[model samples]
Target: MQNVLQYLPQLLGAAFKYTIPIAVISFVIGIVIALITALIRISNKRGVMLVVKAIFRFYVWIFRTTPLLVQLFIVYFGLPYLKIAGIAPDGIKLVPFTAGILTFSLNTGAYCSETIRAAIIAIPKGQWEAASTLGMTRRQALQRIILPQALRTSVPPLANSFISLVKDTSLAASITIIELFEVSQQIAAANFQPLLMYSLVALIYAVFCTVLTFIQGYLEKITSRYTIA
Candidate 1:
């Protein structure tokens, strides 16, 4: 018990150092990518849009199907090999922190795009028609009427995604990011108390997820206030 307490501050500090930054940066960029992909997937254009949609579908498929650890390995270990093929510069290096953020963002973006797309689709056709009748352009209608409602509906799913991303950030340790879980492993290695160390790590993650859940509930209430239901 004393040993566990002794390591608590260091583990928690390392979590704040690496885990939170990776999750926040990745999730923010992921939201941007998801919004863009969702919009592109819904476009009505024929040739260009078809090609774009196909590309994004392939991207989402690849990320969703592969293990994230493999993805991280590819980014961290494989990318630098491009120099050997005369593609990238010889000096190119993929830092663990940068690679971790990039991998997590791409993975989260692929999954969240579908959630956002479905939310956008769920908005009634009547709302678009109503906006059109009011002399609104397609962009205007989407910006004013459809998107707000879609965002409201999207809150729950996106919140879940963010929570999942927080947990997934631990996987960054596989590539030497030295996050919360990695810190636990280090402590356990020295003390020979894997069970106790891991239990503390799990408890910290549960606390983070629980806080996110409360925030999710609060946001749901705020978004629901103006909703008809």
Candidate 2:
């Protein structure tokens, strides 16, 4: 009991210092990546654009299918062996934080792109036609009419993604990130009380996720206020 209390502050500190920042930054960047990917997937462009779309499609497929831990290892550990004669003789290595952020963002972005794509597709064709009749281009329609509605629909799923991302940051620990989970592991090792320490960290994660869910519900209400009824 004393050991748990003694280490509680250290765990919370790690959560604030590493876990929160990693998840928040990754999710924000992931949303940007997702939006761009979704838009590209839905575009009708050809020629060079078709090649671009193909690349993004492959990116989404590969990331979604692979395990994130393996992805992390590849980025952080394996990349260092990818030697280039001129540019990177010792391979392309990144710091632990950068690697973790990149992996998490790409992984989440791949999944979230599908969520965003479906939301955009759910908007009716009539809405696009109406925008076109109003002297709006496809870009204008997306920005002014279609995207707003799609955003409303996407909020719940995207919010869920953010919540999931918060939990997934724990995996960053395996890459040597000193996040909440890693801190707990350290404490458990010191005290030789793995179960209690693990449970405490789990509780902290639950609290973090629970708070995000409430925020998600609030955002849903905010986005739905101007309903089409």
Candidate 3:
């Protein structure tokens, strides 16, 4: 018990430094990518929209169907082999932190795009017609009316995605990123107490997830007040 207490601060501090940053940065980038993909999917142009739909569908399918650990391995370990085969002048060689961010961002984007699309679609068709009757262009209608309402509906799903992302960042340890779980592993290795160290790690993750859940509920309430029945 004393040994676990002694190492708790170090493990928690390391997690705050490494894990939080990776989750925040990756989720931010992921949100941007998701918004763009959702917009592309809804575009009215026939030829361009068809091409984008095919590409976006394939991207989402691959990322959603595969395991994240395999994706991390491909980014961190497999991509560098291109240089060995002389396929390119310079093969990609990403450090663990960079690799973790890239993999998480792409994976999150693929999943979140569907949530965003559904939110946008759920808005009533009459809302668009009402905006057009007021002499608003399509862009203005979306910006002034459609998007604001869609954003409210999107909150729950997007918050859930963010919470899932917080847990997923632990996978960064697989690529040697040295986040919370990795720190726990190192401590366990030296003290020969894997069970205790891992228990602490799980506890910390639960606390973080719990706090996010509270925030999600609060946001949902606030948005609900503004939503039309």
**Backbone clashes in each candidate structure, one number apiece?**
0, 0, 0
In terms of TM-score, how similar is model 1 to the real structure?
0.95
Q: After superposition, how far is residue 168 of candidate 3 from its true place, in Å?
A: 0.8
Q: After superposition, how far is residue 55 of candidate 3 from its true place, in Å?
A: 1.6
Per-model TM-score versus the true fold? 0.95, 0.97, 0.93
lDDT string for model 3 (4-50, tens) is 98998898897789888998899999999898888788777787779
Clashing residue pairs for model 3: none
- Candidate 3 has a TM-score of 0.93
Return the candidate ranking by TM-score, descending.
2, 1, 3
Candidate 3 C-alpha error for residue 22, in Å: 0.5
lDDT of 3: 0.89
lDDT of 1 at 31: 94
- Write the residue-wise lDDT of candidate 2 on 27-141 in tens digits: 9999999999999999998899999999999999999999999999999999999999999998999999999999999999999999999999999999999999999988999
Residue 174, candidate 1: Cα error in Å is 0.9
For candidate 3, which ten residues in a row score worst on lDDT? 80-89
Task: Give the top-scoring candidate (lDDT).
Answer: 2
